[model samples]
Target: MTAHETTLCTLFAEVLGLPRVHPGQSFTGLGGDSIQAIQVVSRARLAGLVVTTREVLRSESVSALAAAARTDDRTRDRSGPVTPPRRFGPLAATPIMEWLGELDGPVDTYNQSLVVRTPAGFDAPAAERLVQALLDTHDVLRLRLPEGLAAPVPAARIPEPGTVSAAALVACVDARFATDEELPALMRGHMRAARALLSPREGTMLRAVLLDRGADRQGRLALVVHHLAVDGVSWRILQDDLRTCWAALASGAAPAPDPVHTPFAHWADLLRAEATSGRRMAEAARWDDVLRPAPAPLAGVRAPGPLDPETARNTHVLTLPPEFTGPLLTAAPGLVNGTVNDVLLTGLALAVLNWRRDGDGDGPPGTDPAGGRVLVDVEGHGREDVVDGLDLSRTVGWFTTVYPVRLDLGPTDPADARAAGPALGAALRRVKEDLRAVPDKGIGFGLLRHLNSHTGPGLARRGIPEIGFNYLGRFPMGDDRAWSAAPGHAFALDDADEGLPMAHAVEVNAAAHEGPDGLTLNATWTWAGNAYPGTRVRALAEEWFAMLRALARYTAKPGAAALTPSDVSLADISQADLDSFESQLGELL
Candidate 1:
């Protein structure tokens, strides 16, 4: 390799934590993404090799980037010290917050937990210190529900990070002596912490437990935080930042993360302020038309009995190795001019339609034998490019956006399995096009429902999609620990589901990882069993896997047209029209 090529390769290896960057490997082929892409550009600038995000995106190899990279001095703004908060201080209810808050039961189901296998010989004090450091750094943990009397505090005052109690930073137990024997006790403590964070009565939104397993040579660190404080993207940034900060502190250095220019509080305030502006209102109006006479959101929920605490959302999982994941990543996104996310949702729509055909349940809640239409509430990470000046990529908090998507799968026949193909293909295409039509990836939904004074979350004003779906990118270990510096450094984050029924009929969250185990896709399906029988939900889960695999095959075929169903909407296409169309396209489809 030439000198410039070798230099770029070294930089890629260091930034991405890879052992080597072959001349043939692309940045993404080595597990790089947008954030990592930007990281390379930033580091490259500092390394005296100027590379733009565009160049990074297009480069086929290290040498390609090297050939185009050039050093150019440019001034950039750096985040300054913390500022005082003025407006946007309230625990302002966005659509997501309102949805969870209005669920008519204990909010403990919003609790999320993650378990980590600490570095060998990792001790309690060290773990506790790391917890404290995180508390001192991230302000999201300082928020609460303002339980009673508004605490008689001064106006416009936002709590700073690390103001909360250190002891409550985490709850720990030394299980080094009896790992197995202490399992039950450890669980109790974990659950206790989770319950504590679930309420503002504790004046905390996060809890941690450090399990000291010295003899066993594996120590476990568990973090339980309320959904109000973090999302999946926040988790990714938090874990990466925590690892870097923890290592620095261990070596006796002060912990510092990339400047959080916009504290979550400021972001929330700005969000509310912006919601009232013409932009948000106009966006909401456009969406209102798109979702009006809202496609009935389907959920296999029977009577959601008084929020039974013991009712846990069960999961039927499917794993896919690299053999499938690798190609799927390349083809799935291109098929619809969408990302892997589109593929997942498309597959989900197909599965839901199939479930309907199999007599799993009725459409939405009512409307007799409804024409084949499914409405689903979809979730996005909420870090869209909409915010021009602020970079929320590293900001921690609940930046989740929820919006309804109506899928028009013209005429699905359960009795005749042969007729399902055309329906599935057309449905997938419509879903892709519908999503493509959404403005700024659906951020307007929250702004209109909660921030907009005119609109309310009430059934008469704003409709609710009974089902929710999220694709949480990829898990760390899922990709063979490629992102980690060493093996056994992988960690897993999961919901410690309490078996409590969700207000919605069912919700699905999928995470991906690629390793020697291949590319494994773990899809967790949570449904209110009373509505859809457990057996039915399980069938849906299994069928989703089959449909997803089928999609991969369909997209991979030679000269397969990733064509749109039609400019004419499926709803416009009458039931009679669908029958006529399906019959004509039967064998060709």
Candidate 2:
């Protein structure tokens, strides 16, 4: 290996915390996965070097790779900031509450797509105009952080509105559209690239990739925003705005509707005020008590170790039909005063308990036999009740938080699954009330305290909630049938779609969808391979569904008749069976 290659190898090893690696070692060969690859690139950038996944994949030797990286001028950091290309309007700022909300943890959920066809009759000038108009219409598109927050000089300011040259825009697009395989890598690269370029010190981050398909109309623009800054709702807004802006440019008209919310800075100030208040202190104390430390890593599961390639082998998604969701929602108030989310959580908890009872052999033999599994972490929408009226939908901030909701399954009687509805409902109400309490609702403060010395080392060592649950708030994209201005533009996104990373533990998400009968619940669980066996996962899902169905029924017909596991067919209970149940339930609703 040449000196440069040796240096690169050493850096990679250090960043990845591997024992040793030679220059010729392939990234994949070194046990690198998407998450690890991101860390590799991030470390390289921090060390003042640039490296692309493609280069890492193709190089025969470390020397060749080092030479390629050296010649790849794009990877090299220019000493000075590039002049901010022209943006359309005043910069948008993140809100304080939203910023506090993000304190909980990093958002691994990401959605990305490659749009291949440019609008019909699209021209370079028109494209430029379209982008310019977009900037003019949304403050978020134009934001640039000024210097003074731990910086020696004022940061580069965004160029005057309408000043970005078509060449620069095209170059950005061309760089991104270089290849199909390159798109995914490019998407990950931009997040790191933008972070370096934007010098993001606080709040959630934003990144984009515009692949120029060349003059003939095959270009792709890949946009990825952190979940904290935007949600499915925000994406719908962005999609509509983009289509509108593109159509207007094609027809020679102006863009429509400027945004109407205060900048993120105003929100950030509000968060600071709220976080520092006496009320916040009390709330923090409550959270501290409620969120006990996560138990030791489950048996057979290693603690936050390097991402293993084996873990990525299986990808599966389990969706509930609309029929199930409809009835569940209708019966929610009576059973647990639960929203769909509460019902879902309760069901999941019961399912987990049953799975443990069934002795799936996925967990360690000594796991609490009574299923007193603790430290359940559920993803939460960090938007506190306090921000009820704020038009957060239009603002750019990370408004989601991940909070821990402990579940004591030991006391839950498996035989009394029907009667468990009220208890589960009460538990959910307490969670909602605690979560809504102003001072302690912010996940960020909780995280900050956990990281600080003042909170005691045990708090830091405990790790955030173990099992994560997130409901993407009912899949809002219309019917599954694809719709785009051009043919084949409609791509189906499913649970197996690439992008979002899974946790080392279990991650669950639920969405409502229309099925043959009615609205069904699509629940997905992406489990860490090393941590869970397939049978265990399957059993857990089945039990959860059965429990939920029972709860829904109990809630709807309180004091009428109680359902028992014996009443249900345990012998035939399966994931597919549960799905069918949900489908039928949807029709009832």
Candidate 3:
């Protein structure tokens, strides 16, 4: 390999914590996701190699990326610190408006939490200072949700320097346990209390608790923020910034202010404008069809209505071990020019169809009467490149867009292994095309549905899918063992309030985490307990896994993964022509 290619390979290996990376190995194939892609972009810039996150996603191999990378810094010096938009009064973001429309009960449980092991030698006092600094720095953290507002027009105030400390926002708990068995209950109690302390109305949007397990053991730092204030990407920014501030404080120096970020309030204003713009309004009919017909709850739902917090909820977790996960995450996605999400959804489509056909009581009986179609509400990180001068790379807030997608796999049959191989491959390709066909990663859907008066009401009345799926990207195993998620805490962010309403009948949340066990894909299947039995959910989960495993195995064969027309954005060829060309070219080769 050339020197440039070798350097790029090393960066990928270091970022992904792999033993080594060859030029032919693509980033996504090695279990890299959007977060890792950003890290690569940062690390490459520091290494004096110019590679954007877009390039990282587009190029198929390290060699291709190296060849395209610029040696000089022409593009590097073209940018400057982005000044945040001026402080506006109350503003509403797309996701916030959608959330407010669904509000039916107590707002206390509508928060997100993250518990991480504190840095070595870090005390509670230092942690408290760090939390205060974060609250002062991130505008969304200081937002106030006044009462009697139909829409969630959250107002945020800029705190003067040295005036941002709220003693009640930070608490230290003594839970020095000798064994790990007590950690779960202890952490849960502290987290629940911390969550209760959060109220947007009171301008108390964030609370931090440090679980002091003593000097001999690493402590857990629990952070709870209102969901309106943070999303998946925001957590990444907060985690990195927290560590940055902690390191500064540890060295007896005040942390410097972060590079200017596009404020949450600014983005919210843009969304409101974009929601009513002609561009978004033009896409209204497309979105209307997507959410036109909501699927019925699985054939045997005990209660046939929307789920609520009062209803009992249950979860079933299924895991794909590192071995299968390796191919499933890397090679399988490469075949269809797809993402891990596309592959998983393909398997889910087949599983739902087959499970229902078998009369397992989890799916429609026999064949799907809708001709093998299932509408699923999919979530996306809503940092789209729609605006010309906007940069949300480091901004923090709830930028999630939940939109509906209909997976149409046309009358699938639950065949034996031999027949299923071909069937699964075809389903994967079809699903990828369906997802690629979505407009702007489903960002505009929420805008038209919530912000535009003309389209909002109709979109709202169209109803939502019974199922929801969110692929929360990959969390690669890094060397920073001291700062990762604290082990032995509660499974979710916070024990959701019992009074909170369930948005979907069934929701599947999947994320791949790298650890000593290698890459393991863990999916949590959550449902309303009163509606579906645990046994039935488990059966559906198993079927989904079976289909995923089949896909992984199928992709292991030669020429299993093929590029359909959708994979080539500029190519206007039909699928049939592409298939014929591949076959003829294979014979010649």
Candidate-wise lDDT, in order? 0.60, 0.46, 0.73
Native-vs-model 3 lDDT? 0.73
Q: Candidate 3's residue-wise lDDT over 21-87, tens digit each?
A: 9999889877777666766765565566767676787788999999998774534555678554854
**Judged by TM-score, which candidate is best?**
3
Worst 10 residues of 3 by lDDT: 295-304
Task: Show where candidate 2 strays beyond 4 Å.
Answer: 1-229, 243-252, 269-274, 293-311, 333-337, 360-373, 385-390, 408-410, 418-447, 450-458, 477-504, 514-517, 555-589
Name the TM-score of candidate 2: 0.56
For each candidate, give its TM-score against the true structure. Answer: 0.75, 0.56, 0.88
After TM-score superposition, the amount by which residue 185's alpha carbon in candidate 3 deviates from its true location, in angstroms, is 3.2
Model 1: per-residue Cα lDDT over 60-133, one tens digit each: 67777888877544345547864554323455454566555545544543566566656656676777677776
Higher-TM-score candidate of 1 and 2: 1
Question: How well does candidate 1 score on lDDT at residue 181?
Answer: 48
